[model samples]
Structure formats: structure tokens, C-alpha cells
Target: MIMSTIFPEADVTEGLKSAMRLYASGVTVITAGQGAGRRGLTATAFTSVTMDPPTVLVCVNRNGQAHDAIVENGHFCVNVLCEEARDVAESFAGMTGKTGADQFEGFEWIETRVGAPAYAFAQAAVACKLTQTLETASHSIFIGEVCEAATNPDRTPLLHFNRGFHAIGALK
Candidate 1:
């Protein structure tokens, strides 16, 4: 099957972005750093890399503040947002006017054994140690070896589609 039949030679950026919006993905916060240096950003470019080693991959914007810390510290957490965590997602995505440590102010967080902080009330979370990294065009692909993980099965996951937040309904 062809992924894209129309290859725009003009501006592929807009074409690619619009095509990707057709896929529904879960919202997550890619967090790094500690204490006063903590930083995070909302991302939907996350996925399981492997099951045997319990690995995962998250694509982080290279220009984000937490990008450098994640590379320097060699650790990060993927906090899967629940439907009710839309505010947290917005804050981390810089849509709430909160930046740096201020984004974490009202949220309850718990530090994992690996030193990355996970959301206390997220739909799910994964603490990972950076095992590999690759620089793409505009983002860093972090391959993490999952050290710890948690999930709240009762909560519905928050999703992103067409540049909007959505709640996944349970299937009967």
C-alpha cells in the first residue's frame, strides 16, 4: 500500500504534517532533569521499540529545553497522560504559559529509582535509561531501556488527533 500518493515538491513540511494528523496517537510528556532543573514537553511521537528488553522510543524536539538535559543526564520518563490530564499536557506543551520548573508546580510527581519523575496520576508511565540516541532532522530519537513502568488501567488514555485532544472510549 502506498503511504502517500501525492508527493508535494513545493513544501513537504505542510504536506507531511497534514498527513501525519490522520493517525491518532496518545499524548505523553517527555520529562527530564531534576529538582529546579526539571524540564518536560508534550509529545505524541512515542512508541514501543521492543518487548524482550522492554524498550521504548520517544521523539523529542531538539530545541526544547529538556533535550539537552536528557542527553546530558542519560535518562527520561514517558508520562502517558490520562483524559483528565489535558491541563498537564497543555502546560508541558507550553500552551498554559508555564515554563521551566513552574510547569510542575501544581502537579504531584514521584521520582523513579532511575531518577526521572513520573506523574502521580497519569494513565501510565515509564521510567527509562537512555540506551541509544539518534539525531533526526529536527528531533532526537531516544531509545530507552525501560527500568520501571506503571499504569492506571481504570483511566481512559488521552489522545491527540488533528491537533486536538481526545479521550479514548472503552470498547464493549
Candidate 2:
């Protein structure tokens, strides 16, 4: 049922990534835990699965600390970023020389009732409790039941397209 005209003439990894890069996806920082155990990862692979029970899913690298924390803590917060939060994305993505506690150094965060960090500046922050997980290849698809969601309507979301962050207003 695949319907794409572009055939891979080179390496599949590069081909697939290049193809997917053409998609503009919202940026979110998946955060879990607090204090020294705090961990977050920059993710573009998050989306809603259902609305009746308010469920969502996010994919995480199987070996990432944030993935481990989400499992151990049984909760996570998806902090959807604004354009100004690109450095926040980079820090969580390990571009900065910071990890764990150091990665969260200067940001003002509000810990949710589920015990996960929700960024004050995020366009939207969703607190969720992990409900299920499916492991496939190198990543785990975590299914979560949303407990609470908040948004800053005045702030525009940050999106990733062609491997760079773009503000949402460029299109609509």
C-alpha cells in the first residue's frame, strides 16, 4: 500500500530520512522525572492517538535516558516548544555539554502532579501517565493517557522541516 514515486537509488537510511525530512512536524521535548533523575529528549514524533480517553503516543530511542525515566517514573510531560526554545531543544538533544541535572539548569519549570517537568515557556505542555509501550527496532512507542494539558495561546509553536526549526506562522 506504499504510494510514493521516489525510489531509493542510494542507502535506505539516508533515503528514508531525506524523505521524512520533507515533512514539517511539531517539536516537543519529552520530559520525565525531576532533580538528578530529570531527563528529556527532543522529539518530533509525537501525536494524538485518540480523544475519548485522551491518549497520545511518543517514540523514543530505546537506549535514551529519557525513555528509561519515563518507564521508571510512569509519567511524562510533552512540552511543545516555541521558536525561541531552539536552544532548549538542542540542550535536551545533547548538543550542549549538559546532561541530566545540568541540562535543566536555567529553565523555570513547573513540576506536574505526575512528577514530570513542564516548561513554563512551552507553547503547550501535556502531562500524561504512561499506559502502554511497544518496542520496535531501535525505539519504543510509548502510549500515554493524558492527565492534563495546558497551552499558551499567545505563543507560536516551533516546527521542524528540512532539519531546521521554523515558527508556525509562516504558513498559517
Candidate 3:
């Protein structure tokens, strides 16, 4: 089977959406801040990039506020959202467009080693030190070294798929 021969790209929107739907991945809240100023956004475009030094990458929309904050702070926290965090995902995804303390209201959080706010209720939290930022057309690829990591014992990750948040059902 020649995989390259399958042609599709005329309407990239539908193709992109369809492709993403079939590839279900965990959701995350990418955050950047210091002191009293903090910004966060819901992101699923995160992945491990290296193992030797424990590095990971996150893709952020170039125009997003979180991207700008990260650029200035050179730090971030990847809070791996758990299955019960659908509301937290929605809040950060602009469902309410709440800013400042309002966005973080009612959520339990703690400071990372680098002092960035991270969600404590998450299944895992990977605190990263910004290593590099590469600019693309509409997004910036952020590479970071895992400075600190912690996991909660009883939590399943939240997954994004088909333009919605989905939790895995019981297996047959």
C-alpha cells in the first residue's frame, strides 16, 4: 500500500478536523505566570519530544495570550487534565472567557518549583523550563525541559475528540 498516493487537502478544515477526531489525545491546561499575574489556555497539542533530559513540546497559537505570557516568562506548567476536569477545560477554552482570578475561581491550585500556578486536581503536572521557542506560520512550538513532575494516584485523563471532550467508556 502506497500511503502517499491517498490525496486530500482541498478543504483542509474538514480534513484537519476529521484527522484530529480519529486521534484522541489527552487534554492539558498550559499555564504561564509569576507572582499575581497568570494566564492559561486549554491545549491538546502537547507531546514528549526527548527522553535523555526529559523534554516535551507544546504548540500554542501565535496570537494567544498564553503564548505571549510564556514568551516573556520563559516558563510554563502543563497540567494534565483528569476525566473529571471537563468544566476546567471549558473554562480555560474560552467557554466563559473569564480573566485573572475569575478564570481560576473555585479551582484548587499550587505553585510549581518555578512558581507557575498549576492545577492540583490534575492527574499529573509537568513543570517545564522553557528551552526554546520556534515560530511557525500560525503557531509557536515551545520546547521545555521537565523541571518537576508529580502525579495523582487516582485520576484518568480528559481526552479531546471530534470537537468535544470525551471520557472513555467501559470496555466490553
Per-prediction tally of clashes? 0, 0, 0
Order candidates by TM-score, high to low.
1, 2, 3
**Can you give the TM-score per candidate against the true fold?**
0.92, 0.91, 0.89
Off by over 4 Å in 1: 1-7, 169-172
In order of lDDT, best first, we have 2, 1, 3
lDDT of each: 0.90, 0.90, 0.86
Shift of residue 27 alpha carbon in model 1, Å: 0.4
User: Across residues 1-172, which tens digit of lDDT does each residue of candidate 1 receive?
Assistant: 8675676788787888888887788999988889988889999989999999999999988988889879988999999999999999999989999998789989999998788889999989999999999998999999999999999999988988888888875321
Least lDDT summed over 10 consecutive residues: which range in candidate 1?
163-172
Q: Each candidate's root-mean-square deviation in Å?
A: 3.0, 3.1, 3.1
Best by TM-score: 1
How do the residues 104-138 of candidate 3 rate in per-residue lDDT, one tens digit apiece? 77788898997678898999999998999999899
Worst 10 residues of 2 by lDDT: 1-10
